[model samples]
Target: MQIYWTKINKIIEETPEVKTFLLDCPEGYTWEEGAHIHLALEGFNAGDKPNRRLIRHMSISTLPNENSIGITTRIKEQCSEFKAILRNLDVGDEMAIFKTHSNVPLKREDKNVYLLSSGVGLATFRPLVLDYFERADNVNKIHSLNVDSSKDFLFTNIFESAPDKKFASQFVDNRKDYYEEVKNLAADKDGLFYVVGSDEFLVQNIEVLLEQGIKPDQIMLDKHARQLPEFLSSDLSI
Candidate 1:
């Protein structure tokens, strides 16, 4: 695989525990909305084999037209070794990115789109929203529902109710309310449902969506093809 080394342009603190690292876009590096990259720390390639702890698969929160590649994530006090190292890195620090791919790209099939996410998982949907706003030719409308118990919502500027723009967004702080909203959104059986969150969160949403009579094909997930059948199984019966 071709690896591209890039420098950090700046960092934006989106919330107390969340930050967006804006990296310099390398020449000839282009990716679609909802793309993710394997970010490797400085010491990742020191030995013959890469250090697993130094690499992380992060979503590209910004679009290629945005001029910078943004990786937005939450860093807690007791976080993983990779996040700890990442939090300490300063501007101009070089990092390696490779194996770029997108599991969830904007699918404009002339139908409504619903984005369901938990906390920082919304980072994966940022670009898709932006893409829709830029030119929503085949899309009908877009609605975003994010559950961040922190209450400090991210990207409030981008995610707002705009009738003219054909977009609306809502934030819920609790699971009970979030799932209720999910059920409500699932009423539109023909709408495309894109979900991003922890495995538990994904399973919970999938269960609720399936129970609501939404088909497996109408739901979009970041999981690979090999891993999708397990999630769509009857074992997730709620």
Candidate 2:
């Protein structure tokens, strides 16, 4: 892992709680589509350490050819302090990135892929979804199921290129049925299942997928901001 520093170039608010930060990709700095980088704030406090550099893992939102590193994050009440620091950052503000790391290969096997995301989990998978259409060959039916509590969907226009395929469900009429709906989405069960979401989302759906007879290797995970449940709370390192 290598450390890199870059200044903020632009910030765009996609939703009230979600924002995307653009950073000038450093010289010779490169990363994969679904790669992730860590952000560290200088004066963040953790325990009694005033100089504690609070760090968080964020997914790279934009494609590699976009010329800049884009980070999209949601400011929740729990991490308000850290998100507030990032939210108030303006253009030219200094940002420290520890490194970009992703072992996910860029190869595919002509199998249908189901991108499953809930809430801010969309941050990690959006770039992968974009990469799928842009890079992979023999790509089969790519389905995206994005669920949010209210009708305020995050990436409404981002995935609009495929009108019939991408499905965004604002759980208003079907407020509490998103989980069940996910099961329905998995019915066809074609190829790879790339699951990105909170711990609860991973634990619940992964169990369902496994019970549905999907192999462990066929399920890929991009667990952001978590460790234990991120790994299924099992011995599985992935």
Winning model by TM-score: 1
Which predicted model would earn the best lDDT?
1
Tens-place lDDT per residue, model 2, 126-228, is 6777776566576666666777774567666666546454323233224247667666766756667777777677777788776665666667776433543
Poorest lDDT segment (10 consecutive residues) of candidate 2: 166-175
TM-score of each: 0.97, 0.82
RMSD of each: 1.0, 4.3
The global Cα lDDT (0 to 1) of model 1 is 0.94
Q: In candidate 1, which residue ranges exceed 4 Å CA deviation?
A: 234-238
